[model samples]
Target: MRLNQFISHHSKYSRREADRLIEEGRVNIEKNKADFNTVLEVGQRVFIDGKYLKAQNQDLYTVIVYHKPKGEIVSKKDDRDRRIVYDTLGAKYAHFISVGRLDFASEGLLLLTDSKNVARQLMQSDLEREYILKIKGSVTKEMIEAMEKGLSLQNATLGAHHKSKIKAMDFAPFLKYEVTKEGTNFSRLKVSITEGKNRELRRFFAYFKREVVDLRRVRYGWIELNALPVGKIRFLNKTEYKLLHQFLSKNDKNFYVSKKYI
Candidate 1:
C-alpha cells in the first residue's frame, strides 16, 4: 500500500491530511520518517506517532437500530435540498453508513455501521434482509392475500409464497395483522423478503391498488424497532447482533423471529 493511501485508510482524514502528516514528518515506517509515496510491502510494520496500529477487524462489530423519521433522506450525500441521515449520525459515530435506505417519505428500522465488511455481508446474503413495513390505504384481507400471491413492481417482481414481509410480529398471534398497524390510515405489516428492491415495499402495496399515505420499516434482518421513537438511533443488543450473524450461517427455519437467516 502507498503511504498516503495507508494513512487515509487508517484515519477518516482525506488524502490531503495524509500528505500534510507525511510532509510534516509525523508518520514513520520502522522508526524512519515515511516518504509521501512510500510503498509498504506485505507484513511491514507501519506506525503513526510510534503507536502500532492495532488492526481492528469488523470482528469489533456494531449494529444500530434507527427509527428513520419521514422526510429524512437516506444518503451519505444528498443532491436534493433535503435533510440527510448524516445530520443525526455525524455526532454519534466516528464512521457509519446507512445499511440500506428508507425513502424520504417512509421511516423506521434503518441499520448503521462503520464496518464495511459486515455491511457487505448483511447486504449480499441471499437468505437475509426481510423488513416489515407498516402502511395505510384502502387495503383488505384480499389484498394482503394477494401479496402472498405476488406482484410486479418498478424494477423487479416479488413472488409471494411466504407470509408478508409485513405482518403482526410482536409475537402475538391475536394481533397477527394489527401489531404493525399504526393508525386508521396505516396497517402494520411484517413482510419478509431475501432481497430489497427500490421502493419495493410501497410498490408491493400498489399491486393491491392500495395507496400508501405513510410507511415505515419496523424491522430489518433481526433487529426490531419495538417502541423506538421516530428519527432516533440505538445500538443493537448483543443477542440481536449474535443472532443476526448466527442466522446468516444457518437455515431460515425461524424466519418469524428474524427475517435474517442463521
Candidate 2:
C-alpha cells in the first residue's frame, strides 16, 4: 500500500498526518528515509520518530452498531460547534471510524469499527440499505416511476447542503419500495437501495418538489436496528460476525484467512 495509507491503516495518524511526517523526514523504511509516494511491500518495516510502527494484528478487530439520533453530525468536530456522533458515543469509541454517515437531520442505525479496512469495505460495498421515510405531501406517480426506473439529474442540489459541490447525480433503480401510508399532507414509505450517495433519498424526493420530513435508516445489509434504543450501541453477535467474515473473505481472500471472527 502507499505510505500514507499504510501509516493511517496501521497507526492512529491520519493519511494527511502521515504525509506531513514524510515531508518532515520523520518516517523511515528499512533505515532509508521514506517519500510521500512510497509504496510499501509486504514485510517491510516502517519506523516513525526512531520508533518502529508495529502493524496491528489482522485477526483482532471490533465492530459495533450505534443507534444514532437526529441532530448529531457524523464527524469528530463541527465548525458551528454542533454535537457530533463521537460526543454521544463517548471517549471509548473516540478512535473508531464510522462506516458511513447519517446527515444531521437523519437518524437510525450506524456502524463503526476499529479497523479501517472493515469500515472502508462496508462503506464501499453494494449492500442494500433500508430506510423508513416520512415526507411532506402525497407520494405521486412521478416519484414512483423515478424510484422504479431510477433517475439522472443535472441539478440535484435542491435537497443537498448549500455548500455541497455535487450538481449531477445518477441514481440506480431502488431494490424495493413499499408505500406504507399516503395522504395529501404527508406520506410514509419503506424503501431499499444499494447505493449510499450523499443526501440521495432526500434529493430524489426534492426533484418532485416533495420535502423529506423524517428519514431513518432501519437496516444495512443483514444488520438491523431491531429494538435498539436511540443513542445506544451493541456489538455484533456471533452470527453477524460470521456473515461479516464471509463477506470479507469474498471481497479479499487474504483478509481473514485464520477463520477467526472478532
Top-TM-score structure, candidate number = 2
lDDT of 2 by residue, 1-262 (tens): 9999989888878899899999999999999999977999999999999899999886678899999999999997899999999999998888799998999999999999999988988999999999999999998999999899999999999999899999999999999999999999999999999977999999999999999999999999999999999999999998899899889889987786445554
- Kindly give the stretch of ten consecutive residues in candidate 2 with the minimal lDDT sum: 253-262
- Model 2, which residues run further than 4 Å from truth? 23-52
The residue-level lDDT of candidate 2 at 144 comes to 94
Task: List model 1 lDDT by residue over 62-107, tens digit each.
Answer: 6677888888888756776689877876666646756767777877
Model 2 reaches what TM-score against the true structure? Answer: 0.90
- The RMSD of every model to the true structure, in order and in angstroms, is 9.3, 2.3
